[model samples]
Target: DDILPDGFTKVKPRKTRRNKTDTTGFPPLPPPKSQSETSHSTASDSNKQPVPNLSVTSTPSTSQVPEDTTAQPPRKVRVTPIVLRDASRWRGVNHKFISLGIKFERAVAVDAGIRIIPKSEDDYRRIIRLFREEEVPHHTFPLPSERNIHAVIRGVHATLSEIEIKEELQQRGYSPLHIIRLKRGGGVPMPLVVVILPKVEKSQQLFNEHELLGLAIRVEVQKNSRLIGQCHRCQKYGHAQSYCTAPPKCLKCASDHMIHLCPQTEQEERKCANCGGGHPANSRTCRFAPKKNLEVIAQRRNVSYADAARDATRAAPSVGSSANTQNVDLATALRSLQQIIGPLISATQALQAIFPANG
Candidate 1:
């Protein structure tokens, strides 16, 4: 090989290049279905249109709409963080933290720390200035505000379809949830529907039987588990972390390097991504995880998993269910399988969490 000119270096052409399409406009959309198809759809779904989902405002694709605040239920103003120096030796107090005519609902403790929930926006604003008091525990700012209510709907007949459920809810004149999913339990055709409600207030109404198209379905509303996300790699939420597309961050120190390759020698000095605390970010103990999870929730909602599993566009199972087998991607197939066994998997996970195997 001959010596190249100064600053010249050997170069190899990229073997793989993304195919670029030169076009001035987007491809044409599919033609609208005929009136017969529309009529048939209307008839099949009992003439009710899909209700407007409200929680989708967090998605990047969705623009926030101005709604009458007076019309809606009480909004979650913010989460105020508090830290107790002696978390283990702390005594439970019944009274609310009051200051300047402002009152916090209650102190929810985690470890030796607690987070205060102000009654409303007005209270939060009033207490904002005096929030960081010198006497009480350290009150932190900007906690995750979005709240979730998990409910398992029962008494839905095997024949009760997703479309019918949506139609029924819409007919009831309730603000529709962004996601109301039916997770199939085992080999059963009918599934247990897990609804993610936009408001915590919905939990009260759920205690009563919900009449969905003559089917008096009972909704058992419970607080969201707020379980740490299962990492795609490790399968446990608060364990080995995988950045996936990005470079892995150190689980201990939260540095630029991987956990194993972390150069910081002090193992005791752990820092979390969720909270600026001395612990791994993956730890379930991180009180800040819930707030961080709200962002994750918003990101996950981009895809309509329930509808994808339902595959309404595909021919009815009667015609030929296996017709699309050749065209299905790995993710789609996985999603379909997940839809079938999600309830079982969830229950199993819950059991596992409750009773971890002894090493």
Candidate 2:
């Protein structure tokens, strides 16, 4: 090394580089090929190593699956509320109120061929009272002249069946009822048989739309206990009271054929007054005895049976017609008549009330 110029430094001899093949030979021996390959190879070189052992298996390709156009998303299910029709058909019919123990109550009848019902017992009572008080004239306002279906839908509390509904209508003196089907909430149409009762406009007007629906619901839930036995004492249908055995005495006389059908018992039993004993003071036979028949001595006195009988009564000895005598006679007659036909009259009245001619 020697210092030459001010900017020059000491010079040293450079080292020579090695050749590429001598520095890093091939990646390592590839090893020999297979025996089968060796037989076909042109030459087997030791420098070249055999191929590494590795599994090479081909996987079958899969085609892309086409999207399913028919597969649909799950549909939303919705339950529609049921709307009832023919509810008003059972109006004016009689229904048994189990809670109240009333065998019969005026039911909401039909308007335009539909039955309607009240919501609560109060409403029912109010409606019934209105019908009774108003009668035919209850609704003074002119009705909607057009035929409109008066439907009452059963609500959540419905319990009545079609048969029971029909029976109730019949009991209230309605002939028959029809069950028709109506769709609820615009979904499916269902059978909705209508039980038509007496149509009273007055009563119908009292109910609002909701009340009418409720009433129909109530009717649907009503139950009917079938009529079976008969009351022997009353000689009527229904249940027979334990006391409904044979009469103790003859209803006509106090005889053992009722012990001659006792007058006091007959009166108590609401029997005909004329048949009982005519008078509490006299027996039935004596009270019904014909008046004294007086014969006319002269042929010229020929008279009709009515006139002759009248004449005989007039001629007969009588203390005088007094208020007390007349009262006694009338009382006796009434008691006798009551004993004979009282039950019949009662039955007739009941029939009339249940099925009024106009009703």
Candidate 3:
């Protein structure tokens, strides 16, 4: 048995190797350090955070954000609304402006004013600036009325009275309306050939839809006037068709016998080749012998071919007539047989009397 001294019986602890802090009686640990504090420290000092041990692992710290460095905030711009005024009543009109319920786009300012002159001028520039933009010039003008009087009078269709023409001019914006007197006669309707002349300044400033319309009316009237002298007799121009001096028949009628020729009169007259007479070439007696017989007969026939043809045509059955077989009735057959037998019996009796011994 292993014997121990009485004091040596207590168990002794293992001794560990000495650490760097063992002489100072403290445990070894990492130096406390931070990026911000290190950045604030002088470069000469070795105050940097300790580099992690090559073999040791460390828990990751929560993420940090850098301080903001922006100098100033952004600014917003202010916009004004635009409204159009004194615009041409006949000039340019916006579709969006007319349709108040539907929006064209976001609101934007636009320049608006009256540019047409003497009649209207700009008074609401502030409101005009609310529009986004102006449309391209259409160069359209308005129909004349009391407010814009004085228009050129164009020609008229159908029959128009002087009072009617004057009223039309007044409505078309004409001052001191003038009308060219229309010629009245010879198939042409009431035709006018004049235009109204407005004052110089206003006429010069305004566009010319009226003048163009007037000129067009004059042209149409002139063209129709030239056509009124046509002839109605021959259906040809230059004279009345009733009084046309063309041939007994027109060129077309003579060529094709169409139109103007009386159908009843034409059918009654026949065309002849031999004598050019309005009758058939061969007479009824001349055509009889050759058609009926090829053999030379002793009979001197008096009938003509034309007459025979006519007779044959009359004797022929109509379109839906039945054949000979359809006309053979049993009753008619019996009557014919009786008549034939009666004649035969009469002949036989006469023969018996002639030869009494044979009977």
Give all candidates' CA lDDT scores.
Answer: 0.52, 0.40, 0.38
lDDT of 1 by residue, 1-359 (tens): 33468857767676896756748567656679999998898798885778778765545433555555687677754544333323432343222233245666765776424445666655664544443342333323333444455667777776777677766666665444643555442334454566555565644475575666777777786544554453322222432222222234556666666554756544246776446677665554456444445444444656354443334224222111233233345557789889989899899999999999999
Let me know the TM-score candidate 3 reaches against the reference structure: 0.15
Tell me each candidate's TM-score. 0.28, 0.14, 0.15
Candidate 1 has its poorest 10 consecutive residues by lDDT at 315-324
Q: On lDDT, who's better, 1 or 3? A: 1
Highest-TM-score candidate: 1
Residue 240, candidate 3: alpha-carbon lDDT: 37
Candidate 1: list runs displaced more than 4 Å. 1-79, 82-146, 184-190, 200-203, 223-227, 230-359
Sorted on lDDT, highest at the top, how do the candidates line up?
1, 2, 3
**Using TM-score as the measure, what is the rank order of every candidate, best first?**
1, 3, 2
Best by lDDT: 1
Q: Which residue runs does candidate 2 get wrong by more than 4 Å?
A: 1-149, 156-159, 173-177, 181-199, 202-359
Put down candidate 2 lDDT per residue, 12-88, tens digits, no spaces.
Answer: 87888664464564565567789888865645565578888798865655655556689788875322111112344
C-alpha RMSD of candidate 1: 38.8
